[model samples]
Target: MLQDYTIKKQPTKTSKLIASIEFILVLLAIQGVLLLFNQEVPTSEVAQFRILANSNTAEDQRIKQEVQKKIAPLLDQAISQSTTQQQLHDRLQHLEPTIEQLAGEYANGSAVTFEHKAALIPPKRIGFAIQQQDVYDAYILKIGKGKGDNWWCALFPKVCYPEEATVTETEEEPVKFFVWEWIKSWFS
Candidate 1:
């Protein structure tokens, strides 16, 4: 029974200091992750583009599609010269007459009106960026009565892939976790 007795090793001050440092490091890592997760995507930097239909009639819808096809490229080209939202708005404002003319080319006798306004829009998902149902500065082309369903896209970020564009999804990358490896390093 006397031979079976064993003494336990007591923790040293250096070991206590190392444990305290490790605890602080883990807390910092947790805080970094929390900050990343809690951050909201800023909406002020986004610019919205829209085309409102004259009415839901087949002919009206067809004209709307034609105007969409024609004017989108021009808008892209115009904004390509811009670097800021204000510049984008200015470029569009300066080009409004031209835009209205081009929109009318495909509108086919339908009235077309263009404007830059603070407009209320529905929540929209365009790529990974989302727009909540809120008012935003927008470039709007109202076709005819403008009483039907609308077409919208993210004009500034260019996140909305066109329906005609083809997209190939990449395979998911494997996640390499480092927290376990980091903890294991303390023993080695």
Candidate 2:
């Protein structure tokens, strides 16, 4: 029988380089998978409510209903009052105080400020009532429209686009404005 011989193999530079590249690729793939897992998963439903601390659960529902009923009439009244061009400012001013009072009352010692967008601008707030009761606090419709004319689908964390307040020469032109194109440019 011939003497048994064994040879130990040393890793070659080419093999080492190949292994390193493969390891790096594997790490990258793993990182990609982890990133995918961590990405924000959107909820199918837009409305997600968190329980407010010290909120009266019973009163909240009742209040939400009341708010919805009031909105339509309030808006109509505002438009009617503003029918006269000169009285338009007065119409806006009249509504501001009422909203402020309502917001303050609703806040219940917690601070809240009412913000109004230009009339030509899309509605920022849209409220719906719970079938159970006629209360203003049941559901507050917070809406935010994007740069497009598309009616803002109500969403949380209201969207605000910076607009310049300008006095217009003609009534037909928007009094204050930020075109969607200009707003987009600012971001770019």
- Top candidate when judged by lDDT against the true structure: 1
Worst 10 residues of 1 by lDDT: 156-165
User: Which portions of model 1 show Cα errors greater than 4 Å?
Assistant: 1-41, 151-188
lDDT string for model 2 (1-188, tens) is 89989988987766666766676688799988766655332222121211122233555445444544555566567656664544644665567667545644544454433343222222223232112211111112321111111223123112222232233223555555444444344345
Per-model C-alpha RMSD: 14.2, 18.7
lDDT score for candidate 1 against the true structure:
0.75
* Model 2: CA > 4 A from native: 1-65, 84-86, 118-188
CA lDDT, every prediction?
Answer: 0.75, 0.41
TM-score of 2: 0.28
Candidate 1 local lDDT, 102-186, one digit each (tens): 8888777878899778877667765544557677878789987787654444342122333323344446588766865665666
**Reference-based TM-score, model 1:** 0.56
